[model samples]
Target: MESFIILIKLLCAHLCSDFILQTNEINNGKRKSGSKGLLFQFIHSITHAGIAYLFVADWCCWLIPSVIFISHFIIDVIKCKCYKDSLSTFLADQFLHIAIIAILWFSLYGDEIKLSYFESFCSVKVWLTIMAYLLMLRPSSIFLNLFLNKWTPTSPNTQSLPNAGQWIGYIERILILTFVLVNSFEGVGFLLAAKSVFRFGELSKAKEIRTTEYVLIGTFASFTIAILTGIAITRLF
Candidate 1:
């Protein structure tokens, strides 16, 4: 229980420091390959380390916090150099951060770490959950994009940003999958209704029937894919 509490604290610190404490200027600075970027990264790493140290202050060990600072600095630098803001990069970044925290936790509580718990990660249920999530995101996006390509407008609208629809579709499917997995089927209806209400203005204002039909087809296809994926997760797990 103590180990779990410490783990949660470490996670909270990571989230707060990475997303909440880091401002837009810091984030943008870190993207540049210059002194400003390195300085912001250093500040970010120090803040993260400081937060974690506060959580384990009673332990009176500096090694763990030192390791965290160094590792986080390296990871952030590499991420800034190699990746931009996207679903895959975001997942990879968080995965690395969590992996570091897990390593630090095991180091501090080596006796509490069990082989059986690690082995559970290889179980079929875990793989199924991972597959369901992956299907909900990129795979579903690609499938829907292909299916709706025929209806895609030849003259692209300058008003909308590039890949906006794909991003929206990804978020919608993930939400639907969450609702289905939790057995809250009514949430799915609410989601659809909310989307319909939001899009109603655009549909009404658009003079072209093709645009309205296209949106409807895409929306339905996205929802259907998420619903089926959720059902599969429920049945398999």
Candidate 2:
């Protein structure tokens, strides 16, 4: 119990320093080569160490702050130099930092935690949940694309953003599926209402009915599939 509390506090300090304190300018500055980048990186690391020390609130423990400052600075420097600015890089960077924090906590209070606590994740339900999410991404996407191809406009709107619809579908289906899995049908309704409100204006002003009809079919089909998938998963559970 105490170990978990310390872990969470450390994570809060990390979130505050990394996401709340660090700005776009600092993030961009750290990526630059030479002393200019090093300066920003140093400042960010100092902020992290300071916040962590304050959160830990142990005046006698200087080791935590010292290690945090050194490890964080080194990690950020390596990231800026080697990795490009992308989702995978960002996730990997965060994973490394959190892994360090976990290691530090484990060293101090390793005896308090038991290996048996993690055994629940090895169950069949976990794999099925992962499969459900994977299905939401590409499998459902290809299915919808092929089904909607018949209604695809001859003179496709050039003004639309590239792959915007596809990405939007992915996000909405995931959200809808999540809501249904949690048995929150109101969330599904709210999501539909919100989307309808946004589309109503553009749909009403459209000169032709094909664009409106296509959007309606796509939206409803996405919602229905997500809802049904969520229901099926819960039933299997």
Q: In model 1, which runs have C-alpha deviations exceeding 4 angstroms?
A: 56-59, 82-86, 113-188, 204-237
Best by lDDT: 2
The per-prediction tally of clashing pairs is: 0, 0
Q: Write the per-residue lDDT of candidate 1 for residues 1-237, one digit (tens) a residue.
A: 445446656766676677657777988888888898899999989988998888656468787678889999999999999876665666777789889988888878756645454444334454455556666665576567667877898877799888888789989999999999899999999999999999999899987999999999999999999999899878854
Q: lDDT score, residue 53, model 2?
A: 89
What value does the lDDT take at residue 111 in candidate 1? 69
Which residue pairs overlap in candidate 1's backbone?
none
The local distance difference test score of each candidate is 0.79, 0.81
Residue-level error in angstroms, candidate 2, position 171: 15
